[model samples]
Target: MKPRLLLTLATVLGFSAGTVQADTIGDPVRGEQLFKRDCAACHQLGEGAVNRVGPQLNGVFDRRAGSLASFSYSKGMSRMGADGLTWTLETLDAYLANPRSLVSGTRMSYRGMKEQQDRSALMAYLRTWSDKPQNIPEASPTARPTVPELDPKILAIQGDPAYGEYLSSECTTCHQRDGSDQGIPAITRWPQDDFVAAMHAYKQKLRPHPVMQMMASRLTDEEIASLAAYFAALD
Candidate 1:
């Protein structure tokens, strides 16, 4: 390559890289403004409010899902808690973009923030609550045993377990037997309602997880409910 051309190319590359880096570094001040406007309706800021529509945002940044004492989380959130997933900035960004996409059946009714700037702002705002450095939890080292106790919920309505099993065949690619995978986590022992909500989320595009999006897109509401029942019934 010619010296002048090489230098010009290098300069362009450097500028592009710098711009990308700048974009990812969220502004906490802007984030706070966005939070108050968008998220404050459901979530309370600071440590003062005990509980509101949603759990208090105080210390929520590093907290695990469903860890709040006061709020009643959906089964999906509870499952996330049991699995030990924490709310880091990156995770929060993704969740804020689409709640169901992150945890499948979370009961967070708010639609996602479509803009990247909005998501980044939300993440920055959430960071103010946590005292410690934030990190997401690793998958459980031990394999999860299927809980037979949950069968009643899954089998509550008349449906064929055989059909449920057949329908669930599609989920095995991502959910896996053990539930540990990249982006995709384990679903064993998940709450029945949460499972239902997750499918609903996907069907509605409220949850935008790619594989679940595709799968949920394919199934009817009844099919989703049936699959939820079957998974809940699995031991």
Candidate 2:
């Protein structure tokens, strides 16, 4: 065969292989379990839930972020939608792993799922719900607001020490006094960022413990920061 023809054939074959690999990388049954445990609180399965804490996730597989009606999305989400971002399995997987990092300033208070398997399962489950075709709205012709650049300074510890003590009282129920609790993980001496990330994980349903999720969900980001700083300051 001519060298030029061989190179063309190799490129076509490589592209075909990549397409096949992309199609074969998810498990729906595992995804379903992950979804029920993690996402069911805010999102309904088969259709039409019209905006709860998070927007309805049905048919979210290929949908743009802020296109749903009646849902009050955060400025971050709306900006992403206007930027023409689509949700493919890969994108969904990354987003579910960590919403804030993937798209800074997203209002979905949930932290990213920590485990790779859990993220993959969640993606699979989401794909099943998205089997139907969806018609996404066009982005408005006018410019949308920009997502604020993340300020690392906002993550600094600057709260009333007494309030930190008060917040720690609730956490000790599971986290324990010395940070040693049977059947529950310890949090003493963990880094400030790690502690905040964990609380975010619980709030986001990325780490599935019902009581923890409920408790974490009720805390504002400011409260989460306070609690995290308090715990990090502990010996």
Best by TM-score: 1
Per-residue lDDT tens digits of candidate 1, residues 1-235?
Answer: 2545654786887655344312333567898888888878888887675677878887776678899877898898999889988876667768888888988888789888999877766666666555643243332111112222223343345445577789877788768756566776777657778987887688679997777776776665556667767777777
- Model 2, position 55, has a per-residue lDDT of 79
lDDT, each prediction:
0.69, 0.70
Candidate 2: the clashing residue pairs are 31-121, 97-112, 110-204
At residue 26, candidate 1 shows an lDDT of 59
Global CA lDDT of candidate 1, please?
A: 0.69
Tens-digit lDDT string for candidate 2 (117-218): 787667766665665333433311111122222245444546444676798888887678687769888888778778788888998899998888978877
Taking the candidates one at a time, how many backbone clashes does each contain? 3, 3
Error of 2 at 172 (Å): 70
Write down the TM-score of every candidate.
Answer: 0.46, 0.45
